[model samples]
Target: MSWTERQRALLGAMGLRVWGETAPEHALATSDAGLEDAAAPASPSDPDPAPPRPAAPERRRAPAPQADAASPPPRASPAIDLGAVAAMEWPALREAVAACRACDLCQTRTQTVFGVGHARAHWMVVGEAPGEQEDRQGEPFVGAAGQLLDRMLAALQLSRADDGDAASRVYIANTLKCRPPRNRNPSAEELHACEPFLVRQIELLRPRIILAMGRFAVQALLRSDEPVGKLRGRVHRYQGVPLVVTYHPAYLLRNLPDKARAWEDLCLAAGVAEAAAEAAG
Candidate 1:
């Protein structure tokens, strides 16, 4: 593609080449006779004659490596009491998660993202892990991806609010409480350490239908490594609760065409939730 003069100048400033454009050639050739005449004139006029020598090329050393704001997790982590984690109530669990040092993730996270939404909602959403925004705010699902999820849940007449009706409310949590540094995938040890908190939350809420978003959430719940496409069409079970798998909102943002499939997953989950509510009523 061709660029305008201003555009090319800007690209040059940024050290990026404009694609498909030929580089302009520079000519720096000087004749030996011209240099000899010029030097002869200078030498005749000088009292102390000395030959001119070229200056040595400047030496540039590479800059030192600066550290990133979020450092990698330490290799070792402190142990957590599974029994204590399982027995804690919502308030206690939130405090415990906030103070947890159970895994290496705890070392790098800005804060722990425990969960958000109603205490006993019929619909629950479980995602993979805390990301940059979630870690900063200490709330699961709190950015662009969260916005899309809100739109999806809104279409289903459900929300992530503490005051909505039980059937219209949705509780959201992550497989891992603390975010991995640089938003990298959560390690198995990190997931294992955080599992009890999620288990206790699910046990307490006992949602009619659980929406498992992203690969790790699916694998953590269903113990299956299958891709979401292969697992989403039908209902599955998790802790005796109906579970539906679907691509994560973040993934859907990148792959817009798969939104229809996500809608289908939502509908399937909705039907399962409706069925469960009716059975209870």
Candidate 2:
């Protein structure tokens, strides 16, 4: 239990002491050897450091090309043959009308209300079809609606005067020449069958403006599903002539509030008519 022996016991517990009765230098040398053994290099079987990761592949983007400014313009379709129709005499046209049966409406019609107005009219008003009153009268507008229309025309300073120029100044027609049962709307088949006559009448009269009154009339002319509320107040073109859509007199009769809007539309139509007449003059 001496100081040296106590030092040796402490070093032995730490596994750095040599079990031998030796000198201080020998013991120090043995302790150095023990420390070297504890610090020996690890085995070759241990895992190696992971290899350096390869860089991500570069993404090749396709370049955007510029549009060609020198491309040729698109070609348009041939214009409709309106001249051939314009050359047809009124008597010949009337004869053609007399023998027409293009639609089922022809079967029920009392007479072909072909149209009434100036043959060379600048303003043409087209309605949906003849009603009970019109069928009985052989005219397009002769009922309460017709009376309203007459008043409307008079307001615009025009009339049914078959005088030389007047006869050629105001024309009227319908989408269908015949009256549907019970004043109902004309069917698509009826409208399709009768549309050619209207087209022909427009071509012959060469009206500067067409007033399409009512939803049916607007739809037939524009071939669109848009409601009359949306269709009215704006000017549209049909077969080179301007078309102004307005509420039918019959509809205005039932809906008094809409009369104000209808009046504005009538004014628009009148303005168009006046402009056309002035241009023609």
Candidate 3:
């Protein structure tokens, strides 16, 4: 019934019992020094108390500075010249592309397809590289897949031509200017070799929107390894222009199920293009 009696009974149930003649509360309050002495059964002549420990020094932190409203703004990098690139004539540019031996892809390609479409179109479509048809025709997106792309553009009310120019309303190019052997995907080396030309093309065209068709084009443009499934249905940035990646028309034609997703991507791309055009106007 008493607390100590109950505690002893509880401990005894577990094959243990309270020890020492000290009162329960006094025993509980006893300093660790007492426990040490009790454990060793020290002689009464021993020092009655242990030496005290020195206190730890307090740590101090520096005060934070007050906010200043008149602080100067951080400097920015120099602005890039995207429009100046348009002044570069196609003839000279094409000549340079044709002469490029930057990568091994140049060794096998029949010819360079230095993009085709309106020079100043609001939209640019970047592909992986030229295929057999593109290499032979010296134009990007001109094969069966190209035909589907044309239809896709038509559906969006975008032409491959400018109002006065006979060229299409969209500019199309590849990550690689030249076709890889057997239509294989362009290697990183080939893409690197051809990237500068594409960058220049983007600078010159200054398209408001870029539609990177397929994974290779997306990877080259975005410098990402995320799958096209993850890349699609979102707007990304490429050299400051909005980019919407989707399945290549070639892929869409092969996997009919993906046609709906491709259509959605085109709609998003068209919306960006329309907004850019409106802003320009």
Candidate 4:
């Protein structure tokens, strides 16, 4: 789409340049002038007349064919059954993920990131999907974004890996097991195909608090299309677990100012975890 001044400013904020970019000329045109006017109908009395045509060549028409009753109808393909995957335990679930080919992403992915950290931690960190480093390392959040996430977790006295203490342990996983080609956004079908694995993980862990990072992660978990800015600063729930939305670490890296807002989200999540513990006690 053609970028407006406001859109250009937004792109600048995200550290992007709009100059020399190829975009549709009239993409940002928010007027109906180009559209056909429904109110003004064409009148039969209009002055324009049809032009005369020269002599045309004649051709024979083909006969209509009848349906063949002898031919059998084509059978429909069977749908992928997620029921078996949902019923699997941790080991079986990991195996299922390794062998999962329900989506096209499987063909491009080097390996499925089955997630790391404590299996039954009280806090769960969910990201959108795997990146290049993550896919290569077979772990989620492994690059600069992952480093930022580590610092954030350290600030909260939480560790994705087992730090020899159960209370400080936190589980980290992504919305999709496999990364999309070129790290593009995961399609609706891909998410749908991989959702059972995520759902099963949540069910098995039953984390008291879930921190959803990025717009896609929040959208998948909450089933809402609202932007992360709108969804943040408030606690939501997922399958009875307290869920909080926040900017992804990769987003925070580009928009440094939003890191403060992410910190706020983390604090809110911690509060929820404490309350849950007190209620349990």
Q: Which candidate tops lDDT?
A: 1
Instruction: For model 1, give the 10-residue run with minimal summed lDDT.
Output: 25-34
Off by over 4 Å in 3: 1-88, 162-168
As for candidate 4, its clashing pairs are none
The predicted structure with the larger lDDT, 1 or 3, is 1
Tens-place lDDT digits, model 3, residues 98-137: 7565566766778888887777887889988888999898
After superposition, which runs of candidate 4 have C-alpha atoms over 4 Å from their true positions? Answer: 1-80
- TM-score of each candidate structure, all chains considered together: 0.73, 0.66, 0.66, 0.72
Per-candidate clashes come to 0, 1, 7, 0
Candidate 2 global CA lDDT score? 0.63
Error of 2 at 72 (Å): 60
Q: How far does residue 257 in candidate 3 sit from its true spot (Å)?
A: 1.2
> Model 2 RMSD to the real structure?
44.5
Clashing pairs in 1: none
Could you report the Cα RMSD, in angstroms, for every candidate shown? 26.9, 44.5, 32.0, 18.8
The predicted structure with the larger lDDT, 2 or 4, is 4
Identify the candidate with maximal TM-score: 1
Q: Write the per-residue lDDT of candidate 2 for residues 1-281, one digit (tens) a residue.
A: 12355445543443332222322332222122222111123336625322232232233322232366686422211121223333567776665455555455656768777788777777888898888888888888887888777766654555655456652356888888778878778887677655656777887778877889987887677775556787676566777677778888888778867766665666566555555566678
Tell me the whole-model lDDT of each prediction, alpha carbons only. 0.75, 0.63, 0.66, 0.73
Q: How many backbone clashes does candidate 1 have?
A: 0
Q: How close is candidate 4 to the true structure, as a TM-score?
A: 0.72
Alpha carbon deviation, residue 247, candidate 1 (Å): 0.5
